[model samples]
Target: MTDPTPPRPGSRAGRKASGAARRRTASTGARIREEGAPRVRLPRRLAPRKSPTQDRARETVEAILEAAVDLFSSRGYARTSTNHIARRAGVSVGSLYQYFPNKDAVLTALLARHLAAVESAIHACIPPLRDPAVPLRDGIRRLLELLREVHEADPRLSRAIEQQVGQMPVVPEGLAGYKRDHVATLAEILSTRPDVRPGNHALMAVLLAAVTETVSVVLVHAAPARFGRDEMLDEAVEALCRFVERPPGRLS
Candidate 1:
């Protein structure tokens, strides 16, 4: 058989293919720049798209939110004002009102953004629950690892969400319930283990959250010099495993 002719680069057909590939690459890069470049990487609102006029209106709405987080997290919510958020964000009061109805709405959105961030971080790292040992220390470690990863990734946001914002009144509190829900899940997993009983899940949940948050506070934030976060997280997971696996008679 005759040898195949060598393919010619820069030929008409080759150039057309190369040009198409270059366009695809450029368009993909642009999409990535837009999608990947998030402000604070927070989730956007679910509201419908605005008309061109409304789009100009949205700049002020964004400013209001940005200012609300800064002021509310810095000054007390009671001290911050809609007018203040407007001025600080560099938009007019009327412009701010175009999106947000009141200060509470602003606070709620910010808190939601915070929660959405932490939760998204957690969800992204969580693998599928397929293994039988998932209810055991293996599963517990996954959660602890996830918790630590989130805390270590954004220690400030963690502190702000768990403690600072929880204390604020401008936003209606969902945090207590949020913690309780996590506790409940932990309790459920603990209950499935041989040593832990179904009755103790509630208590275990409290313990789990307490240990995780305490370690996060002390090791990661309060006294970084004295303790290590990775060490604390590993130890906390071990302690929780003991709580679920240790027999009732082995109680200290």
Candidate 2:
């Protein structure tokens, strides 16, 4: 066979080059699919398509959201795909897309839903502090307990959402609004309590909000074994009560 026609003048080399090129292309395509898929284009518009007027539709939305949260907390945002969320939700990808545009949209919706739940919980727990019948220290403890419950719902998911939001180029305006509302609510509650001598309700509210949030996050997500949950709560309550209920003329 004449030595196979001298291997067709670089045919073997060409085959090797083409094979490498194909692999390179495949690798590049995979990277693109992983990293360059659509992100949260409109973070603000992360609402379900039809508002889920029907009970079943609402349930579907909840399922999708819960599945997204589990995936985000466990698989991570970068690794979690819309398809995975849909699969976990037990809904078709088309149905998932009907509600969420992409993975980021689902994250945004989950964050919004979580914050709303927190707000509702805060309203339920903090408002009772406004009652004169409730002792200041007791009220503080109750608020702390309620917050602990909220944070405990899914600490891993909460932390993951926090990190994802932190990575954003801009803070969500709704989050800022929530903070303002919480501060305002706390200020009103403190204003009602005669024992609280903070002198400045707004400042006191801000401080309490900061302290409670920091403590809750630490206790729920990263508290050491030595610092048990109840111990952490007690310490946090003590700190807040002290800060808000200082002796008259003691605060500068």
Candidate 3:
């Protein structure tokens, strides 16, 4: 009878099988490590290729941005392509690429421009808010009005840009800084106000900023016909004032 035993380790068949098993083990180990490892997402290149230095270059960039805004607002960002933006701008695709790296970069530029204008308006309005003569509710109402005006100036564009930002993995440059400045400024102003109840001024400022922004966005983009802007604004002002101006030891 034949030997009822497998090949020895030194034999050719045994060595071949051993090598195949080793390779399988290695492949499985590698797959496990790959599966267990966290994925690293590189930041997107949202910045423009370069700033426009000449009037002609500036005009070309502006045209591309304007075209992108129109397309993004009308067709939506998912439907709008770089080629469409170039054609609408009446510039070559190459020219558009010379300034903006992609449509996202173009949108970033537009958002930055819009934010800068809004920041300027907010800064201008802050002085009035800081005045002792300005009632707390009145000051809050004015800030809300300013936000409404800026958002209403171009509601479609504002909504489109905001929706895209919500989907983005990263905030555009300058946006975080703007928020920090906004919160810091508001906190400082709140701390100085005699009527504002003493607590965490920074936290109050953050809440106020959030409420105003949310109300303004909703009113501009998605408010129902029954919810008039003025009525909503009044309600918001009353609610915020109650929160920030409640007397000490008052639970309500």
Candidate 4:
């Protein structure tokens, strides 16, 4: 009778088949990586096709951006398309193209708008932080609260923009300036505060800012059900306060 068994692992045929399978797997992985890599878009390609000068044009652009935010937030960046955005916006694909060159360009515009709002809110908080009456911890708390509010404005959209930041050019080109400004401003304010330890104010500002942002983003998205917002905020405030108030300790 003919053998009904498949090739055994120890057999030469099995080894050959395994080797071919490994090669195919490797080729597939390479192709997937290539396809998944972020595309380097040229500046012109990312820029809007035209500025919205008229009231009607501006309204159309706003509608498109709003639609993009809704779609990108609900469906995610990968699933959302330019056609979808235009349709949701109640505009023609050609109209959206007139304002945004492509989907990435729409994303860039949304990122810009969101960043501008955040930057404004941050700047507004800086004046209060500089107030002589405001305690260091209190000022920090106020700033953190403001950041949380801004982030909460459109949490889903904010998360979506953050997720797609790597694929867009605006982050490095536009966001860098805003970040530098915030860092410099915070450093300056920290230097003036009498309670702050007399070390590297710039580094301190960076740490404080980073911690606040990280904590806020985490709490907004991945926070546990048991942990309330006020509880998390209090913990963050205490942690940041201790870092700035306490002197440097030796590493064990």
* Local lDDT at 227 for model 2: 74
**Predictions: Cα RMSD each:** 15.5, 14.7, 22.0, 17.2
**Residues forming the 10-long window of minimal summed lDDT in candidate 3:** 29-38
Q: Which stretches of candidate 2 lie over 4 Å from their true place?
A: 1-44, 52-60, 168-175, 248-252
lDDT of 3: 0.72
Which residue pairs in candidate 1 collide? none
Clashing pairs in 2: none
Each model's lDDT comes to: 0.54, 0.68, 0.72, 0.72
TM-score, one value per model: 0.59, 0.70, 0.72, 0.73
* Tens-digit lDDT track of model 2 for 143-192: 77877787788988888887898775555676547789778978887787
Cα distance off (Å), candidate 1, residue 202: 2.8
Superposition-based RMSD of candidate 1 using all C-alpha atoms, in angstroms? 15.5
Which residues of candidate 1, in runs, are more than 4 Å off?
Answer: 1-59, 120-130, 149-158, 164-180, 195-199, 217-219, 247-252
| Steric overlap count per candidate | 0, 0, 0, 0
- Which candidate wins on TM-score? 4
Q: In terms of TM-score, which candidate is stronger, 1 or 3?
A: 3
Candidate 4 lDDT score at position 213: 77
lDDT of 3 at 152: 85
Give candidate 4's total backbone clashes. 0
Worst 10 residues of 4 by lDDT: 28-37
* Regions more than 4 Å wrong, model 4: 1-44, 53-55, 169-172, 246-252
